[model samples]
Target: MDVDFLLNKGKTIGLEGLEVYMVETELLNLTISSDKVREVSSSKTFSIGVRGYIDKRVAGVTINDENLRVDAAFEKLSSLIKTSVEDPNWAGFPPPRKGFINVICRDNRIIHTDYAETMKTIKDLMEIMKDEAIREGAERAIVAEGMTRLGVQKITTANSEGVHVQDECTVFSTFMVLKTVTGKGESDKSFWIMNRRFDLAELESLGRDTARLSLMFGGGRKIENGEYDLILMPQAAVGIIASTLIPAFSALNILEGRSPLRGKLESKVLAEEVGVSDNPELPLEIGSRRFDDEGMPTSSKVLIKDGVLKQVLHNYYTSSRMKLENVGNGFRRNPSSPTTPYPTNFFVHPGEVKLEDLQREVKKALIVYETIGQWMSNPFNGNVKATATHALLVENGEVKGPAKGVLVTGNIYEWLGNKLNGLGRETFTSEGIVAPGVWVEKVKVATE
Candidate 1:
């Protein structure tokens, strides 16, 4: 579609400002069940979103059909904007900005991946899983379900304010559930990995780790109720931090009175060793992007500096309302949705202590690998109640055995603040969250 023509037409219709967003996507998906390829599918889709401003109010419309008529869509969008109720806080679109950086977000290999290559990857993953299961002493491990998806997306944004930007990105993701049945009992574990680049060796490592965890899950025992030091692995820590802590840093949440950091800016909120940043410039990271959905330039910003509440994530709307700087966190789930603030490549800075050293520092603790019901926890008040799916009991700086059916209960603020002990040197990224192992003291762990 000709974006220039659309914008001209909107202006001629007496609209104050206009913006258009287009996304073209091609995806390939493969699913495996019972250790066999179950289905393979491919899809191609195109969507166009149009936003118009009249007076101070703005509204949007999206068209996904192949037979989209740009002229008719623009007419409908104008009518919707005119009929929509005016927002008292409505502000004009962001003015054109300069000095935009280019980030490498696409992989040509993944963009050109075909059905044959996808099938080969599936077969290789199955073989690797089998080999790793045998090597891990879970030869009977069965892959109950698995999925592999590869996608390429082309995004373009144009506004009447002389802003035009375009970019492309590729994504590869895979997940699997492996179950092992022993003479004593049955145990299962799941693993997931995603990245812009394809690495068969990484997939093999994931399989080996999953198989090892499943094998250890057998003959598990519950721990007694007590106050124990806790070592949260990267996966377990991300599950809680991303769900509970990260959302509180949004300016919108604070404006809505749902965030604990509303009036706590520049205050010490966590341990002095704790630092957090939203870095979109990291190479090969999934969330790295040059511009946000609103055509605003993105940059790395320190959200928390040495435990002090430094900054909150904001988009054009929230920043305008609060009279703050826009950090390029604008995001929209789809063309028809309103833009909101969201983090990109969010992570916690690693400390100097290594994971092994941090573990040795603890006398008695639980090493949590994975958890359940983390998202259901409260984020505003910082209450975390989660069940450890895979955990190891440690005593006298020695791992005893697998501990199951253990509940980890604590307040996120306290655990990350006064109770925080150490952070691991090694960092791991999962679903765009990069973090290291975190150690905390005086956590409540019990069977119930």
Candidate 2:
């Protein structure tokens, strides 16, 4: 595709500024069902997105055209711009910037791996799950379904402002849901693992854990409704924090008065032991990137430090609208979509509190492994209400039994502030949220 041609054409057509974003992706996929290989396939896609500004009226168009239909895209964009209302705060597209930090976003191995290798990985993972289930005395367990994906994407951003940048990244991820039957009942659990690099050993470990947990959650019984101290595993902790607290740190939400964290910068919003950051420069993580979609350089920054709200995330639009410096957090789900503020890789800093020691110290806490309905959490008012689908009762520093159908509800501010207990010494990342196990005191738990 000729980006220069698009920019020159837009100028001749009376457009003040123009931007072109292109993505080319190649993906290899393998799906499993009922412990059998359901499908194997490969695909390649080319997408083009164009955004233009005409006298303070901006419009964009996105198309999956491998042939590069410049004329059609421009016609649609022109029509949309003419029908759109002019924005008083409209600014031109961002110019090119330098000093982009180096981040490990690509893995050559994933790109080179073939279909046979991916299928072998799936088979190995299933065998590991079976072995783990047998060791856990639940040999009746079987893999209900799963998928493995290896993909590489090439992203190019070019605009009339003389900004042209390109990036390439690779991703390998897999997930499996295991189901088991026991004398009491049937239970199922799922495990997901993703990274820039592919490693079968690591996937095997996750598979084993999934199998063990599925068995543990079998024959679950309800606990009494009352206040109990809680210990959240890394997955559960990430789920709650990502849904309840992370969105509130976006400058877009703050400016629009849709965030509870508005006007709280530099304030002590969480416990002193709590800290959070957005570190896109971290190596081998799937979200690691050196530049955002707008060709802005990316860097690691602290959002919360020593319990104080240190920095808020910003994209170019939000920061410019608020008259604040752009921190390079701006991203778009697609090229034609408006830029929004989002963390590349959000992390809750780990602490020195060991999980075993913390569990022993809080002997009667409920250990929550996974949750559902977290997306229903309200970020504007900081209200969190989610059901703990996989949890266990712990007493005297030992697992008592499975506790299911537990409804955990609370306000985010209260849970991370006064009710906070401690954070585990180790950290894990799932779906771009890197966090340690989180503990809170006297949390309200409801059951039927």
Candidate 3:
């Protein structure tokens, strides 16, 4: 952790320029309930973050391992920049730069896994969710809950402009919660998968597709509100465009005016069959990163091409206060957060139609597959409400079954402009963007 002697000990404690971020973690957790495998855990952590600047006033600090000494993180970044407040767009940190794109975000067999090989892959994912909830007949199914997590991280960065850097990654996620019953009653469903590698046949096809979609919500109903044509699924279209159109491509929400793509960059604004990108060299996606959180690097951009409005998202202090060109997406939602303009891997471009040929050109749709208050969406005016805790109603194009709670509501510029309709060419990345399954048209649902 000698980030070059903690940036030369913050210039012998006077603090003019310094930065040193570090994180080290290793974790493993497993849980499942009432139907067994109740718990197993492990963890290791250490954190240290510090930023300093004197006259220009910037400050930051985070410490653990009992104030991981470096003079107690530069005396708490010199008493928080002595009552901070003086950044008229202070530009002092970022310096080192290089191509850094080599991706494949770690997964050496989950760092040589164990715990009896992840408890025999969670008892073969609960015997493949009890043989697919007894071939979907379910007169009482189980796997009532689940969880599995494995993590590893290393990250480090230095500063005072010589800008050092380091990185390491690994993540594997899983979640389930099947539960079913017959006589037309109980049902519960939940499924999850996250990556960076680890696949026991895709975690037993995510416990046999969450016991066949929780027995197709056994006799579900309730659907009657208004304008339809929805479809969504790629986890509800990456959870309503990553919570309402990716924070309007934050360049600090377009320089504080809370973005609506403020001043609309290259114009257009969504739907020439929509396209988007941010790609940190794709590969084993988990928001692959090379250098950010201050040390720069990381590239690949094109925030929307056919729908124009190309590029928006920066980092080093919003590209040094909007002077542009810092595509590294700064990021830092912890380690004493600070740097911000996010998005490292964010694609959306996919189409060759197929999700039953885009739900056979919709004739009354709904599909959505799970959502809940999509973060009470509203990226400043690109409104969108959520709550379709699992849907599926389509009519002419088939599947007239499940529906629950519903609600939806829209407006990301009229659902990506003029009710955009068509997207699925099979893509998936969940909770970190990489989408597919979209189609829009009408929208505005509701129910009882």
Candidate 4:
């Protein structure tokens, strides 16, 4: 699309390379609470982001003048980069793309899961929770809020390398957090299910069962502090491992004085069973992209394959500094961090054990029904101290009483490197990882 613009600009003002990249994102969200649609929102944004070279002066700009008058914005951006400090490490774009893989193979028009479908899904989910409460003693269940989001993005990258590609991506996600109130006590449960296409229908059971478990722990009591087997759910695993573990393997974060695994590539510092990889080109991943933000083709980089410390996530800049190649994980959470690198839908290979089997194997481990303050963990040290909610007492390898008033404290690295023992049969598909449930040998827990 911008090939014509770049070529025209080339004739007017000769340059080594000229590129105009455009990214279009459309989001449709539906939020409901108590069987009533609270909000229906739709939005779209187009960014005419350009990167080009003019006599060793690498300039870049994103034209966001929404009134279709972005040409002025482009001129302003083209002039703004002239004032930037010369980046000696900056490199031109990669070779032209050979071809493209239609990541969004399905009909993009059907990607939006509207309020009607989303509300129906919630009704079914509530029914499951109501059934669970009937098993208990609660008369009725109220969902504080239930929501689903559908997003579609079209990315076009055209550069002087004879590469012109446009790829479409769509992601569907649903999240629910509910509280089950009883005369004994009230307990809360949070659940988030996401995928490239799987929406609320794929999460009915999870939404219901998680809420059911919340009601079961209404009257929680305190327990003593000792080493017990710790059970992790897949979403919990992503919240735990994906948060801390990412720091050790982030090449961009490493260069920014943030990553812990700055100098430990190809080293065995983690459990042999733990593995993580990035393949956004994966069949259906929320974070998958045909090319990273900088137009680098994404690749399959093994970060912790079979716990051997194979490699770390990388982008063009970090790869050049480390004297390696790009792996296409350039993460740009917002415009402020365009070059920032992060994980796509990171993959964690599950062990041979099944979810039910893992539950049976843990004879007396305390299944941490929920953990608090995962975000508070210090990735530099992996030190985490948090309270446990809906913590269940699994006795003789069977879940016993739904315990409460418990707290967990430990370093994630030590917890995963030494305390972790078996992988669960059940795996969770989330925005960034397909992590499986993992069992840890011991954790310091205190009951109130």
- Candidate with top TM-score is 2
TM-score head-to-head 1 vs 4, winner: 1
Q: Write the per-residue lDDT of candidate 1 for residues 1-448, one digit (tens) a residue.
A: 6778878988888899988888888889899999987999998989988898898778888878665876677788888888889987878778767767777778777867789987887787777776677776764878899998888878888888888988888877888988887654678888877767566777777877787777777778888899889999877888888778888988988999989999999999889999999988776577888888888898888999999999999988899998876758888889866778888888899987777775666788998888998888898888998999898888888888788799889988888899988888877786778888888898999896
Q: How does candidate 2 score on lDDT? A: 0.85
> Residue-wise lDDT of candidate 4 within 239-302, one digit each (tens)?
7776677766778677777766767677777688777777666666676666766566666666
Residues 59-178, candidate 2, lDDT per residue (tens digit)?
A: 999867554677787888899999999988777788888879989888777878898877877887898897788788874978999988888988888888988999899987888899
Better of 2 and 4 by TM-score: 2
Q: Per-model C-alpha lDDT, please?
A: 0.83, 0.85, 0.81, 0.68
**TM-score quality measure for candidate 2:** 0.96
Q: All candidates' TM-scores?
A: 0.92, 0.96, 0.39, 0.84
Q: Write the candidate numbers in order of decreasing TM-score.
A: 2, 1, 4, 3
Model 3 lDDT per residue over 129-238, tens place = 87788777888787777888887888888889788888888887877787788777888788776767776887777678778877877777998899998878676778
Q: Which of 1 and 4 is ahead in lDDT?
A: 1
The order by descending lDDT is 2, 1, 3, 4
- In model 3, residue pairs whose N, Cα or C atoms come closer than 3 Å (at least 3 residues apart or on different chains), thus clashing, are none
Model 3 accuracy (lDDT, Cα): 0.81
Off by over 4 Å in 2: 66-68, 396-398
**Candidate 1 — worst ten consecutive residues by lDDT sum?**
130-139
The list of candidate 1 runs beyond 4 A from truth reads 66-83, 357-361
Better of 2 and 3 by lDDT: 2
